[model samples]
Target: MATTNIWQKFKALIPEGSRTIVTITANNGNGTSQAQLRDGSVVTVKGESVQAGLKAFVQGGEIKGTALDLAQYEVEV
Candidate 1:
């Protein structure tokens, strides 16, 4: 047996209505923004000197595999 993540489980068990939507709320010129999750969970977005961030919400068939590098700040800006 192999371990599977939520993405993979959803694909195998769910047949419909498994889609999720993402909305990006822009800053009010006050350097504030947020990414609203489907469940209404909010994760604050800090406006870096680059004034950039990434909101990647994935829900689908399979999450092949992933690599995360938080030290070098590569995933999100």
Candidate 2:
């Protein structure tokens, strides 16, 4: 018998959220902004220039195959 398994790849770019940890890749202002994770974890990003609309990349996670906001559980950066 041959074991058959299927795997899928998912990718998305999401905006910053309340329970998200974000790092400033590039900031153009005072650079005092920061983010927090849902698990009470934190991460920081420093830069002198930031994009107008900050976004984050998420992947390698299992979804329920439903239409929902995955960013809620993702770290913001």
Instruction: List the candidate 1 regions with Cα displacement exceeding 4 Å.
Output: 1-22, 48-77
**lDDT tens readout by residue for model 1, 1-77:** 97769888778886653443333444335554454565777654433122223333323521112223234334765
Deviating ranges (above 4 Å) for candidate 2:
1-29, 47-77
Model 1, global lDDT:
0.41
For candidate 2, the lDDT comes to 0.34
TM-score of each: 0.26, 0.22
Model 1 alpha-carbon miss at residue 6, Å? 29
User: Per-model C-alpha lDDT, please?
Assistant: 0.41, 0.34
After superposing all C-alphas onto the true structure, candidate 1 shows an RMSD in angstroms of 13.3
Best by lDDT: 1
> Candidate 1 has which clashing residue pairs, if any?
52-77
